[model samples]
Target: MKRASVAVIPAAGFGTRFLPATKAVPKELLPILHRPAIEFIFDDIVGAQIPESVLITSENKSALAMHFSEAPNLESHLQSNGSEHLLEQHQNLLSNTTIKYAIQDRQLGLGHAVLQAEQLVGDRPFAVLLPDDILLGGSSFLTKMLAVSAQLKGSVLALKRVPPDMISRYGVVSASQIAANQYRIHGIVEKPSIHDAPSDLAVIGRYILPPTIFHILRSTPSGALGEIQLTDGIAKLIESEPVFGLIVEGDHYDVGTPQGMLACALTLGLEHAEMREHLLEIFRKWSQK
Candidate 1:
């Protein structure tokens, strides 16, 4: 079983959902609590023991790369100021991992963004995690997916059962139970209407894809959005290969929207020991008002 050595995170989206705020700042750099949202994805990648992370970003988001790169001036300032705490936090700057950048100059689609990493991930299995979908939990769904991919030698996806009304918001899959919490994905439909949806198992951001996906993505036709949907390529891959899905356990939150970002910040803030009591008092006063 080959280990997934590289993780590809597509961060090139215009983040139109977060306009003005994102006008000068990339959404991936948006802070959830104290750290940037994309850092959580990096934490997951580091925890899974994956060595390389390929961030697919654009010219406008060069800060994404700089955020992970070494900053000599900042380091010196921290050292001279005796800000050991702050300095220690950056000790694992970029987690001391090899961070690569692939430029996605256009908003073609998720498939096109991921294709940018083909050369870097040649002939090796890779993991793709969307930066917008933040998972908060103790265990790593990615670690399990990697293990499954290794055992089955097939691609695996992270799935969560969304309500029927919300099924259309995601790429839903028709799957048959293969084992406890595991399923054999039979089909994938991208943002299908409820009436035509195959099942309620919505595909989330995490995926352990075999290198073969790049080839399929190249020939896939753009969908209604005029963007190359990743699901389109996955659907095609399943035609000649096996694709599995695991119902992941996590507090899933989509922070692509302003409302969602607020919810995530509030949720995470309330869970922090230092802020829990303070936030409780704030919420209590708000309720009285």
Candidate 2:
């Protein structure tokens, strides 16, 4: 098989969880350590070696489009200031990638949001990444998942072993071990109660899905929340085809909420070898007060 040719990112949600700050800014544009959250996602997508990406966004989210677009003035300004490194960084962001945009008219659920990119995706295996979930590690999460998909030739979902008590917060999957760090998914239960959860394995945001999911997403009716849940569509896909879960070798931070965002920044800051001492000193000063 010719490797998944495209990646579809769903960025249309209102991000009501962040409230006032998000009122004027799309949550995807929120910055983490001076870089927009979506920039991290784009970097990961590029690391996966996929040549094309489709960003599914809403009308109000034009800021995201502009951010990724070429900035000749900014490039020239950086160059004039002798900041050759910075200019190269800006150039790298636009190079070696073909980006396409698809508009989602309504803020439906994730499944509906992904369906909007069907035409761009065409009939082939593709990846879907949720910007809300930021994953960090020595290796790219998508890259590892793609390797698993290449070997299995089936859908692959990044899995994390969450606390049993927190299973209700995510879509939990029941799976049987297929090999080291791999599982054949038997079924997926979305946000089930702790007592009802099938397994502790929860599906994070990254996915390698076959094109059949588009039809499943379209046929899947809106749920009680009047939104098409991606979990529901995945459940339908599982009925007819085999789906696998690859336990991602990394740490995942849910950046959709305020607390989670702070945690991610702190974690990244603490891990920075150059800034660790300064960050620790600041923490110590705050503790003394």
In candidate 2, residue 214 scores what lDDT? Answer: 95
Q: In candidate 2, what are the lDDT values of residues 152-238, reduced to their tens digit?
A: 888899999999778899999999998998999999988999999998999999999999999999999998888998999999999
Q: Candidate 1's C-alpha lDDT?
A: 0.88
Local distance difference test, each candidate: 0.88, 0.88
Clashes of 1: 0
lDDT of 1 by residue, 131-212 (tens): 9988888877789998888777789999999998898889999999999989999999988999999988999999999898
The C-alpha TM-scores of every prediction are: 0.96, 0.96
Question: Worst 10-residue stretch by lDDT in candidate 2?
Answer: 85-94
Total backbone collisions for each predicted model: 0, 0
The superposed Cα distance between candidate 2 and the true structure at residue 122, in angstroms, equals: 0.2
- What TM-score does prediction 1 earn? 0.96
